[model samples]
Target: MSEPSRPGPARRSRLLRTARRWTVRLVVALAGALLGVLLLGRVEAPIGPFDATVALRPAGGGAHLDIPPLGALEVDAYDGPLQLDLQLRRVDEVRAEALATNPVLLDGVVDQVSEDLRDAVVKVSWMTALAAVAGAAGASLLLLRRPREVFLTLGVATGLVAGTAGLAAATWRPQALSQPTYTGLLVNAPSLIGSAQEIVARFDAYRASLEDLVANVGTLYSALSALPAPGGTDDTVALLHVSDLHLNPAGFDLVRQVATQFDVDGILDTGDITDWGSEPENSLITAVGTLDVPYVFIRGNHDSAVTGGLVAAQPNATVLDDSEVTVAGISVVGTPDPRFTPDKDATGDPGSLEQSGEELAEIADGLPEPPAIAMVHDPRQAPPLDGAVPLVLAGHTHEREVTELEEGTRLMAQGSTGGAGLRGLQGEFPEPLTCTVLYLDRATGALTAYDDVTLGGLGETEVTIERTVVGPPAPDNGETGTDGGTEPTGTPASPTG
Candidate 1:
């Protein structure tokens, strides 16, 4: 009856206009609610109160943790369970020894995302449900007067929730697979200092090896089976072997004395010419200037890579950079430090040490013939000489004053040739570099090694002319010492003693 009364044009127009207004308002409200629900669905986990502690143990044992409210946690080897045993506790604690394992990246996608968004998501989900119910109730109330508007609002709300959920699911992925965005050196100051101490200890070990080598050389000189006549032309082959000079002036003097004493034919300046390669024109090359013969050099890790390039340009100098050179009919090979390479590859799997070793072997192969002498910075590179090379010259591991590895290829190491002998006295650092001369005979290809300079005064630190003859009845050539090996038999030319 009321509708029939609305037959009046003004009343009918007002009614129709009011209905349209109501429909528009309903549609707007529904659309806004749907959009909000979608946004809420995309939110992530919120930050929660948390604390953690990791205590390492040793001996395959695990770690013990006291997280307080989180309770004490015990982790075993490979992050195993934590036990009460003292040994077990030590196993985890021992992680302090490994530099790489100590600091580890945190895992899990939840950890990678922000906590605020997570909390927001939870809040939005619950709120969205409430919103949906409200929307439905409002739509129902309008059904009698604006059925089309009510239906439209309901459809919009549902679509929003569905769309948001779908988007969130599509974007979700395991964060573990993501590459690391941050990195830092894990070494602690104290640990670094301790490592330095270890290096010093290693240098001590290196020094020890040099002493042993010196003793052996002395023994060889003392027992002369038969002095072989000097072979080759007036070009008497002088063996100039200088080790661990550290580019110090005093070291050069020693080299000069030895050179004059042995009358060296050629010079074999072993590893560690300078304290580091960065400082150019150090005592090593400066002292080398005094020598008239060809000078060959191999790099020590302590030497700077930059300086290594410079050595090649020096007069009468042949810098061996993973390459070979032919001097006096003898072949020589050189290698840089191997530590610069990594143990793994792009796949995150362990790779072969062959990458480094084989390259070195190849360099050694470049030598003119068999029974070649190879030079390197570290002793670890001493092994696997590719059989083609016999003598391996090394200096990185200073024998704790003097030591040796039995049953392996002959390894010549000159302990620190520096003044203080504190040279390379860090962890596993070779002893102060000692100086030695290597004599290679072209006729029979026989080789003899000698040390002209001791770790003493400045006069014995420079490079000198050295000459050695290999034949039956080796000539004294003013050099002292017999075949049995005592001191050099040649006369002291420059005062290396």
Candidate 2:
């Protein structure tokens, strides 16, 4: 027997080389096909000459439209001139003209444009798929003979494509393509184009309504401007008093509107600017600071130590916790709340509230001139400062109240300016939003009159302003009179523009 001839070493090596070559070719072919599929998936074509026109009248801000199947189309005619721009993928050429000059011709142009774009998109998408397949097949063939070179080429191409896509994704904004200079209507289907035109007409009518609204607002502003300004005396300084905003952004707008309408010289905030005293809640300070007048703030239980720091950073804000500052000719002092948590009954350490009141009283005693006004978060804490200050302003009760202390000091406890500070939004029964505008005798720094403005609770829209006079007789010599005070006389007032 020939003892089963064993394969020679050369023959075995040849067989191994062939097996390895075939294995590499298979992997390369699979990889090439995968890369081609990924590239193809990213390809997109524009379905245009779809016509889109945007008409914006000067009075209205603008309107936007995106016709289906096309990339995106935007027009901005806010400045009274038609500006249009169209964006589409794989479009060889696009012809657009301002249809504003000829309304009758718009429908025809849009029909032509839409049809052309649909055809182009079909052709482009098909062509792109065929190219991707052809490229993948060619790469697979090249890998079989030139594996090393083919790998290098594939890697470089993949890197380039990926890098380009990433850059485009990061920097591209669809709005950037909608420039103000481009003007035209480009679409293909007459019916679709007609719909687009109808949309523009409706938008134009809407713009006309907006124009009327703008004119009415302008007229209202003029009427307000012509009205007698506040007391018409530099001695009469108005202060907008608010507190317990609790992160309600609408409160800021309402405050600004009131301040502008009242022409207040400054703002006085008691406390509870935020609910939890967090870092993110600090953004409320920017809105508060934009009032463009002196802003005196006091810390509340909801205000953390960081809240104080943020308030201090505002240009027009002053943090007054156991501290006194003179603003708008009146000495203002503040006492922070004792509690750190949300519990109304929790006053932190047992003596903290008393201690805070004592500290504030001490500060007031040391002042050469006692503060014209003292502010605290809780009215319960106001009695300690009763005779020490003429007026004690406070929040946290979520209900507005005015009391005349035996010593002639008045404690004005304001309602929650943010409608119970978002807690009102959770329940069916929500607290109404309220704020006060105080008119002070610039000379005596005494409260002459005040407006208690109450708006609908939480989501309600009713607003009522009750103007109240502080006297049958004003306080004597800037101090409360010895004679027993009369109840404040109030009359309803309309909200001025």
Candidate 3:
């Protein structure tokens, strides 16, 4: 067979010029389209009471929500050349507060946010498409300097944008919301992302739970506010005690509600903030920063260095691992647990628990001044610290107990603030979520009184709060002055935010 005929020099040169010309057109077109979207693809709209913006940017095809200050939540919504960016901007505090407090307002807020998000998405989509086409045409006209080439480039850009949109819509995965990846804390995940299908779905299933929380807060406040505040001196500081949250969302919500209703000066957590020390469990602790009060934490057996680090990273959080911090006019010291019970990487000696307690006691005693309160994850560590501090707090058994030691130290063992976390629901009956509100005399840092708060187990919303006044025996009751508290008061109620 004869060899294939070769093109003449003049014909080859013509073909090369044509190929180079087309390559330049494609490159300039892509560059212009990217710039256009970068400049004009954003749209701002009010989502509920929040001002949020949506934009398209170059990324590996996913959606990201920027919550500002706290952190960001990212979801794999789709695959494409461009990623979706949602930025949370100014919020109407008055309206937001009302929505959080009122269930009726929250219902309207859900619908309002849905409508606003839909509108913003639609607007941004159109803006991005137009900008891409315009940019491609402009660049082609400027560089190619040929009207025919510019027109061709505009058509190509428009086709490409539409094709990309079609691909994204086709590949959109709603399941991504179930498992989102986040930067910072995962608590602030995007409420409305993925396909538009969920926007119209009803979320009333959570209304009763929310209502129960609101009603509980209101009734509890009513019951407590009617009584006079307790203290030896007029200057008394209040603190909220929580522990064993184990990554429960409802538990965190309750914590926030109780904190707000009581207006506590600070919060003391005895640890186990997550079920597993994995990265995914960081969401529950994110709200710790939003509590708007000093959060003092001690690591429990279920906690790890990562959990402690996360807490320490928060703006209002302080983690004490054999360290001391003064909050709300009270000096506090704490020590982390000897080991994470479920840790696979390290098997710290459980036998060292007592030794750890002794070390913590020494640290507390060595402080410049005796601490008002000392913290440990397990009650096992409480004995050694009896004389080191006036009060010692610990949690680990998921039970509440108060005892006055021989050396004159009061040990307050808190229950699980998260109902022992999600594991509490695995059995026939769920464990009750419990916490306490402690009152201290500001001048002398003396124990005045405390309220033990309990929420009914999972699937139940009933709440009960018991008031225990600490002081000398009252002659009126004629009862013995035991470590067990007197003047016990209880009320039924339910809470969350």
Top-lDDT candidate index: 3
- lDDT by residue (174-218, candidate 1, tens digit) is 442121111122112122223434544544444344434433433
- For candidate 2, the per-residue lDDT at 309 reads 81
* Model 2 stretches with alpha carbons more than 4 Å out: 1-232, 342-350, 472-483, 494-497
Give the runs in model 1 whose Cα sits over 4 Å from its true position: 1-236, 280-286, 339-355, 366-368, 400-408, 419-433, 448-453, 457-497
Clashing pairs in 3: 213-495, 216-494
TM-score of each: 0.41, 0.54, 0.59
Q: Which ten residues in a row have the lowest lDDT in candidate 3?
A: 191-200
Q: Judged by TM-score relative to the true structure, which candidate is superior, 2 or 3?
A: 3
Writing each residue's lDDT as its tens digit, candidate 2 over 284-345 gives: 57776666798999988888888988988889999987888887898899988877864443
Better candidate by TM-score, 1 or 2: 2
Off-target runs (Cα >4 Å) in candidate 3 are 1-28, 44-53, 65-74, 87-103, 107-110, 181-207, 213-356, 359-377, 386-391, 396-411, 417-431, 436-451, 465-497
What lDDT does model 1 reach? 0.47
Better of 2 and 3 by lDDT: 3
